[model samples]
Target: MRSYLIIGMCVIFLIQYFLKLQWLEYTVVTLSLLAFLGSTLKADKFPRWLGIIMMTAGLLIEWNKDTGIEGISEGIFLILPLLSLITLSPLLSIPLRLGGYFNSISVLLRNLLLHPKKLYAGISGTLFLLTPILNLGSVRIINEFLEELKLPSALSAKGYIVGFATAVMWSPYFASVSLVLLYLNIPYKDYIIYGIGFSLLSLVIGNVLFAIWEKRHPLTKEAGVKVPLEKQHQKQLVKLVFFVILLIGSCLVIEHITNWSMIVIVCLVSIIIPLIFGIVSKRWYELIPRLVDFRDRTVSMLNNEIMLFMSAGMLAFAMKGTAAANGVSDFLTTLAHQSVLLFAIAVMVIVLCITYIGIHQIAAVGALAMQLNAVELGISNISLALLLLLTWSISTALSPFSGLNLMVSRIAGVSGVQTGLRYNGLHLFIIAVIGIGVISVIG
Candidate 1:
């Protein structure tokens, strides 16, 4: 059953991509709605009210656009549910775990954290020297400190989770930036250097500010928990290495094949690699039961309010397709005076606003890029990419609604809202300083 479902999804995706079945979008959407509704009705574990609300919200979005029966038939409705599925999938767990492992090197990490000042300086220095690697490494180190020191779990989680944003700040290697670079036919190395300079400044400034703030309002000290030294260490290590190789390799592969979107590549690797590794062992028949389990668990964990937001995305996308959203791009361009500073600030503001409204960073960044590209603004492609990267990194770092935040919160046994808010100021400061610096230099 699971294989069939996955195969079906793949087939549908292929049809959408290759056949350009604008009409099939309605069918996709209708099925997605049905699945959402059916899952909500049959599941007892998750927040049913939330599911109903999401379904209702999706319906409202469809109605507002006057998408009508044709929209439903065209598979527009499935967009939200499918997007939700991809966003909320276990596949993402691979990256999360990779991030977690790099963060768990206690002794080495503690040596750095002991001197916060030095650590911050080193990170800043390395930002330019090692832009491609610093963000991921910095987060891992911070996470190790948080976990080892037994700081308030919420604070610890925030520190580690926010690291993702830091990495995204100026890293040219980031998929989001890479995509924009590819589209514009810009040199990857030049943009990466630009990103590095901005990222380093942000990291240093952000961490310093955060450390000072914490010193003034010290969090309640948490009791140190025993580290799991022996039991799962080897297993964890193996998984971590595998994840790193996969992530790096995925990027390289995509760089070579610019025709395929990053998401498709990620999805393919996620499904295929695990099977090949026996991480998901075959008694191939067992796959169905696992998928059923997955669906059940996912449905049970449903927060229907998420659907309303997703519905908004569908509406936006649908409108964009039909030209209803063209005005939005025009409005954005008009607000800017073509001055690099003004355009940069405007892009940041727009991304921030969209993020605040519960939109995912990936979607927001992609949408903004497309709009910006359409206008043929004088903004340098590298600068635009940098701004988009900053927006995405900051938004993802600060949003409790993000999957990364939710997962971190769950793992640390803390509230997602609390985690998001705790790190919000720090992320903004980092992005502002670093983002501005990169834009200025590139522009």
Candidate 2:
């Protein structure tokens, strides 16, 4: 039954891509949601209220003339990370434990010293480092850090939450970069290397700017609160490490042997290998049930709303088959002809804005790259790809609405609005300056 649903979803997706039918695309999304919900129900973990919310949102989005399969696809893509977050409990526990130790000490010392700036920065920075280690790692670390430091729980949590909006700027292992590279037909290694540089720049500059800002405007202090840590059985930690190492090794091997997309490779590792191995295990009953439970929970949280949003992409693609969204590209090209440097700046700014408005960096960057075909721009593919990489780094790293940002925020116990308002402008400025300089050297 699951296999049938998977096959059907893929067929529908392919049909939408090839035939571009709005109604068919809508049906595809609807069926995909049904399959997801059905699985959740079987697991007895379905959240009806959240499912209703997703359905309503999907309907509203579909009602809009501009919303289609293309839009819906983008929506689905954007929500993958969000869904990943919901399912990350099993995966994130280890890193969180490791980072929590440091958080606790930082929080306690800062409170004792009565240095709010240092306290906030210390907690935030520690959580930031913890983010790339695991899914909910940052949150676990921050919560523990706050408790150990004897700082107010609200302040510590809020600071940790805000830090999520910034961590993706540095974490190269994130799914966003992987997705963008896949969509754009770019090499993952190129993105990984370039992203490392961009991520470091964004992190350093963003932290410095935020630190300076805090010195200028002080907020009220609050009392600390304590929460119990989720204990990880030693066996689970060992197994988790084994799984992660295996997955990473598989990716590197595939990257060497085939030019197939990183997303495909990731899905194979994240979803397929586990399923196969679990079935083969003597403890299949236990392992399979747990894996299914994780998948159902993740789908329940992320799939419905994303499927609804993806319907928009279907609709858009239905309306215009071969002609991509060229408005932004045309605008950029006109500016590029005037000066490549200006073109690079304009692209970064546009990507930044799109990201702020809650668009995923992959979609924003990929769509822009598609529209700005190198053939049309009289630029080498490598150069255009590099520019896209830079823009992606800036947008994904800085945008509070991004998946990485939201994940960090949730873990840190803060709202996206708070994080965005606090860090967006400063990160944007730094990325802009650094982007122009980097592009000049590369060009």
Candidate 3:
């Protein structure tokens, strides 16, 4: 029954995309709230407290304007499509796992690993390349390999956090980029162009800082150990690279020809490409049961992420309808008049501060987007988008309550606040300073 209802809601969500009717959005979103509650009661799977808070806050904020019900409901409706995409990601992950391609490369990288620095670079490098296709699913692959090799937990954790954050800034497929694009209305091409340089700089800076930090580690001396790659490893890696390029190329071409948004293209191409490969390679039948099991189990992982963002979207809308929101708009416009540099700095501060208190960056972005979006602050859309992306990435790395930090904490067997938050505080500060400087110049 639960599965059936989930399917029904997804179908309605798809229809709502084309219909674009407010009433339909309200109906589906209301059903989603009920479904969340029903899932807890029916399946013994409670919604995360964050989700509950988001949904409730969205309602209260909207009620302040007499539109909380429909407004928040429609907000849920907006994000449900993304929820469907993320929860359904295992459809791609399962095939990659079964094919032994990603794992083979991961194992190869591990085997060739020398010292802390190489390991840091290797792990971060692999994640940077693979994250576009694998999303968060890549974390488990990297984690399992690191554990098998008895790698330093902090090294791998820091490497992964940086790599993943860097990738999310520019990846057309990432929810960060997608959400920013949705709100900013910037061309995806422009986003990629502006972000590529900054993204690479962030990744390079992070890995270099990580290497410097490793000087205190005992294994820094072992970085030069000789390890040779076998012919088979070389072959497999090349094939995997080609496969990734193929997937990316297809998505880019389709997006260019159709003029569809990158997220929409990503959602479609991620499914189509893998499905065709599975069938053509004759792995579809054998992988079907495993895929089904993965879906049933892992789809629940999205509950927190989906709930937080949907609720944030609702509150953003609710805020938009209020006189206070109007007042904020006027104030921000005044700031814009004072200086674009100041406006950009203010945005980073607001986002960073809100995220520090366990509020999702999206909530901050959504809350301020309307006000900032309407102002002509001499900042390019791409600049604002990149700033938000970097801020989101940095905050998640340092926020103990962030989903990624919590997950990394569990994997590293450390306190989320102490290890994930305190450990990365210095790196985040550097990023914050450099990032704001760059935004000031560019914006």
Candidate number achieving the greatest lDDT relative to the actual structure: 3
Tens digits of per-residue lDDT, candidate 1, 135-253, equal: 33344444445454544563455445544555565444344554455445555545556655666566556566657866786665333344444435546556655655465566556
The weakest ten consecutive residues by lDDT in model 3 span 38-47
Ranking by lDDT: 3, 1, 2
lDDT of 2 by residue, 309-382 (tens): 33322322222222335566677778777777888778777777866765555445645644566656655555
What is the C-alpha lDDT profile of model 3 across 1-443, one tens digit per residue?
Answer: 45545555656666677687877777677667766665443331222565567667777877766664555565666667665556554566666677777667665676656656776788877888777667777777788776755655677568778777776777776777777777787767666766667777877887878877777665533443344666876787788778777766776687678887666667666557667777888887777777577557665445555556666666666666577777766676678678766766677777778877777776777666555663366677777787778877777777777767777777767777765565577777787778778877776
TM-score of 2: 0.61
Error of 2 at 426 (Å): 1.6
Winner on TM-score (2 vs 3): 3
Off by over 4 Å in 3: 19-27, 39-47, 68-70, 220-228
Candidate 3 lDDT (Cα, whole model)?
A: 0.69
Q: Name the 10 consecutive residues with the lowest summed lDDT in model 2.
A: 312-321
